[model samples]
Target: MRAVLFAFALLLAPSAPVLAQALPYHIDPGAREIVPSLAAVPSIRFLTTADFPPFNFRDDKGELVGFNVDLARALCADLAITCTVQAWPWDQAARALEDRQGDALIAGLALTPQNGALFDFSQIYLMLPGRFVTPVAAASGFEPASLDGKRVAVRRGSTHAEFIRRYLPTAGLIQFDSEIMALDALSKGEADAYFGDAMRASFWLNEHVGCCEFAGEPYFRPDLFGDGLAVAVPAGADAVRQVIDYGLARLKRSGAYDELYLRWFPVSFY
Candidate 1:
């Protein structure tokens, strides 16, 4: 009875605003997307791993939960179809998908050439943009050009470090062994700013309160950062791919995506 009441309440609640200004993902508001019929898709099996937190993982309750888990349910709900999500070990997920054990994989699988050959991918819904974090005092006058002669901390030998070497060549680059150490340098005022993956940095910002804040806009260089997160479907599953993409677009349009985004990512790295 309690479960039924809660479910009924959800049906009555309005979804979040469509294309909220703070949302990181964007879908064109003017475009008329004809969502394909999902009558043919009676149900879906979404495979993921119980490791990548906030994306997919077992919660303290030992239930499979995360942004991807909720998103998969949202996809099915949008189409009014049945769906089940299963968590597998990282090593065995690809093999299980290849064996037809699941219809889709939403485990942040990289859209690589090798994976592309093995599976079709839905449209990218999330991007791991690079960002800068500076001590609050230094954040006000921050600019990419002003980074020249500034001490910027980055993880040693990382792609982010390489990005700074190529683009912000004039900045004095200081490399640390890990993101924690780099952020620590910024907190200690040893570095003017820290540059690295925004999502990862957001976690740090959440934990270390009042020490630093994000500066400058997020940077998306897919060529350097690699392609962003997308759903992986079985190879030759064009119908499945279309349906997944359509559901994603619909979520963005209806503001359900915004609701989920805000719930999972409180810091709003973008």
Candidate 2:
């Protein structure tokens, strides 16, 4: 009987390490380890541009609403921190993080190597592949190579611009400050097609531009696009990065992230 009990104990010992690794990290709700300050520090300010809808935008009441805002709220709730949404121009918002004007940039901005050198990025939380959106009246059955000699409208400093320059260099690229402006250019017949994230392009097409249709398949340039959207923090903010990363990992694990994605973007991503 003693030999039998010893054998049973030996069998259970090997499983202990596996269980330990599966244990979730215990995070303090109201601590800087997971947020910024322990006691009532200013609410973490989220810098974003309200021009982009379905990602980040100002509602009729001047309230910030969209996927990024919802995600930020969830992260704040998990961290036991309060968040203040601030609307700034996209270029200014990027600069704000570098100038330390805000705690983080939650604008659903893509993570690129050029931006990485200026700011530290959290783990990518979502993926948005670019697509070509053109007027229905334009020649149908458009392909990537078919964009040759066509005028393409793209937002300045966007992956779409980078994509055109690299893959469709012969195409005339019209740069705009915001996605809305690009869509306007497409509507006004100033450009033959507008290239941008499929989700954003869909939103614009459905709500603003009725004559445009998505062309071909979604084009993904891993090198130019990097990963999905991540919160940008001031360089050297290791603590902030750690907290954001932990909260993001937890959100992904808790199934809350998918719910938020579905809430904002009803269309299938992949």
Candidate 3:
């Protein structure tokens, strides 16, 4: 939950934006139907870490509760199988799955070609794009060309920073040690804008009475953010992967994804 608080602290303006925020219906629109079948395994042991809030995190009761946890439960229900989500250090979770200590991994498992060789991943679920947060009156279009010559603040050495340097090189780059610092600089007019995690940027606007709003469209680089997070089934567990694919698609078509999304986000984090 510290990460959740940190997202809030980074964007401190605390006033609502003038724009009307809409439900993010564009999320995961590519889900396809899959016919589920019983896996050779009886139940799925889902490996996860509790540090990523809204995705997976421990509640005040120390219970594992969040979007990923609930989504796992929903997938299992759809598959008519039992699922046990276990938490560990984020670093160890992947090894635990590779060691065969867990049957699946579903805590923001980034899907990449290298990982694909080691594991079977379900379809994309959520993509966190880098976005620019700017003062409302200074709002710019959501495009790389729009950022040219603009002073952009970003966390030094972060994926967001790397993306800006690589893709939007013309933007005046201002590096900082922390996202909070970058955001503070943006609020104080030290920078023309802040570029970072879209969800956190959106939520930052949710809390602070808005001195600024997310500019342009959300930015994403597959090499940096991967092709979004997906459930990771053990290598060669084709049946299990198929079941996951089917279950997730069902959830998307049945509106379960939206329900779970709202339950966790509460505020618009688009």
Candidate 4:
């Protein structure tokens, strides 16, 4: 997710242009648009980092594994071309891709405005949310503005941190160095609430009883998260982009996407 001192989570790097505090969680199904040249592209080199789990990471056997890897394989199959999933260090990813070392990048990276000038990204397939987590008793029905004097905890310097400062300014902010620390603050009553990734919060709450529960709507903002995760390709690589779009569509249509999603993300972000 958004994991960095300067992380913008998948936007790890913008999430929302404005606060979309409430909206139905549905992505309309559509036909895949294909670029004829994608069929002619003999191979696709998928560049990704191995640190983002559930999306991209190395398994116990040291093999690259995760949603991105599976998707890359599926997209290659859709295009009827070979694809190699190569893991790269985070710092070198941009340079490597720009130098023509790889055809695409899919390490849970966001489609930021800055990235728009360097590469084109496929349609966003997944969007993580900024959520509020509070003790079950304290998780009363509330909205962002309702946290008038609540002390909220957050990972220091995360997109969610920024979201709270900008949107929930009335709530006091308690910054932690790590997610565990922030969550602990809520569990221990050191903080009245915790703001962060909805999916992660779901999984954590499900695992740790009496720890916390969802307190409000999941926030969706392009300026807050960047537009979710998409395949990044060389600029003008229309064929490659289209192929991925088509494959993702087929995956959704046939229920393969749901299956993979459950396999990796047992908890839903939405």
Candidate 5:
């Protein structure tokens, strides 16, 4: 059955790109058929971390909830799939998908090459800038290049860690399990500054970390951050991957993607 479905998917794949570009609202015929089977496959789990709020986080009731969760649910609904959301430790989520413990990663993961080699990414659904956040007193006087010998906190296995390790090799790097913890380290003066996705950094600084403020202009590295966040599938899951990409294109053209983005983010971008 899987082979037959996959073969059908291949037959439909040739027209996907053209359809994605021409029609504002289109769904791959092949994907529509496979959608029903998704529910029966208990192996088709969605992986995410429980601590990353506003993106993917656990609510007070211990139910997984947030932007990524909602997006994942919506995507599954569009695909007519029953997707089970599971909380994997942050560092293990991607690995879980790679090992086939899960089918997809809906964690709003940035598309870095190192990751790209292991997984296929859906179309970029959201874009976020990276920023430097420091104590208010230190914000005005800080410079990215000046952190030569200072300690900087970044979430473990994050793009921030990738950036700092590559760009600020001379600086001390402290890897934390969560952004909240990294901010806490900064507040306690254990680290000179913390860096992360600008929107998340701003949200955290405004609501929780009052001691720090964002410094430096926001910039995104295509090499390190890629275009934006996407759902990642294990490499070679072409049929499932094509379905997701097609669904994403449909969502974008039909304005469903915009509506969802506005519902959660509100800020508009052309």
Candidate 6:
């Protein structure tokens, strides 16, 4: 499929030069810190699912590699603690954590109320916001408010579609079955702009090169888009959560987080 190939291409692409100036920092380096009052963490067991490429997946060499795996290593290094990241089927990952087989879940698990009952989540590290992409020529002039009669492409029944229905009601809504379909419509000029997950849009923009570019500010309605990605630790694991948060903040302060972001996402979404 075109989307799959695009993702593979993105993974193979050389790491781009650091875009920290343009990229937004998810964690504030200068924020007041609450030193976790806990015994030393000698080791950590991080559980993840491999099906989610770019986050956690097996490489052609059959070795575990991806942003999440690398991030786990970085976190461990930051704390000077030993850690093991293990992959399991998507369905089994949460259960493994529930069974005390892992210390934390690093995969992008949805932070829903149901899951909240079973786990405590770390501060969000990444948000998948909605963004608009238009033909390069139209990108400069594109404005969310000015799209009186313009067509906007989005995946049918997706949160992005609902966002358009509620917020940008004036624009004509064009729905597709998938993000790729919506992007394809935009590429052919069948739609004036395409609005969808910013991360996915970034990949398409990267693969298509000059076909299109991002326009306007990104929309981050967490209530509609779902809570951002966070590490999930078992219930009552406040100490573990605090430790992860400390490590994450340190990563942000040290610029290691930005380096990993650029290496994994050569095309900056923000």
Query: RMSD to native for every prediction?
Result: 7.4, 17.5, 4.0, 6.5, 12.8, 2.6
Q: What is the lDDT of residue 260 in candidate 4?
A: 62
In model 5, what is the error at residue 18, expressed in angstroms?
A: 33
lDDT of 6 by residue, 26-80 (tens): 7755432766643666778999987787788887788888878898899889888
Write model 1 residue lDDT over 151-266, tens digit each, in one string: 99998888899999999999999999878789989998899889998877776776676889888888888998868889999999877777888888888888798788767665
Which candidate's lDDT is highest?
Answer: 6
Model 4: CA > 4 A from native: 1-28, 33-38, 77-81, 138-140
The local lDDT score (0 to 100) that residue 61 gets in candidate 4 is 85
Which scores higher on TM-score, 4 or 6? 6
- Candidate 6, 205: how far from true, in Å? 0.5
Q: Candidate 6: where are CA atoms >4 Å away?
A: 1-12, 18-21, 28-32, 37-39
**Whole-model lDDT, candidate 2?**
0.69
- For residues 75-177, write the lDDT of model 5, one tens digit per residue: 7777676778888987788889999988889886667779989999766666666778888888796789978999999989988898998889998999998
**TM-score to native of every candidate shown:** 0.88, 0.56, 0.81, 0.79, 0.54, 0.91
Model 1 global lDDT (CA atoms, 0 to 1): 0.80
Tens-digit per-residue lDDT, 225-267, candidate 2: 5566778988888766767777776676676766676555443
Which regions of candidate 2 deviate over 4 angstroms?
1-43, 130-197, 200-219, 224-226
| TM-score, cand. 1 | 0.88
Name the lDDT value of residue 121 in candidate 1. Answer: 88
Local lDDT at 261 for model 5: 54
How do all the candidates rank in terms of TM-score, highest first? 6, 1, 3, 4, 2, 5
Runs in model 5 deviating more than 4 A are 1-44, 130-198, 201-220, 224-226, 268-270
TM-score of the candidate numbered 3? Answer: 0.81
lDDT of each candidate versus the true structure? 0.80, 0.69, 0.74, 0.73, 0.68, 0.83
1 versus 6: better TM-score goes to: 6
Q: How badly does each model clash, as a count of residue pairs?
A: 0, 0, 9, 21, 0, 0
The 10-residue segment with the lowest total lDDT in model 5:
13-22
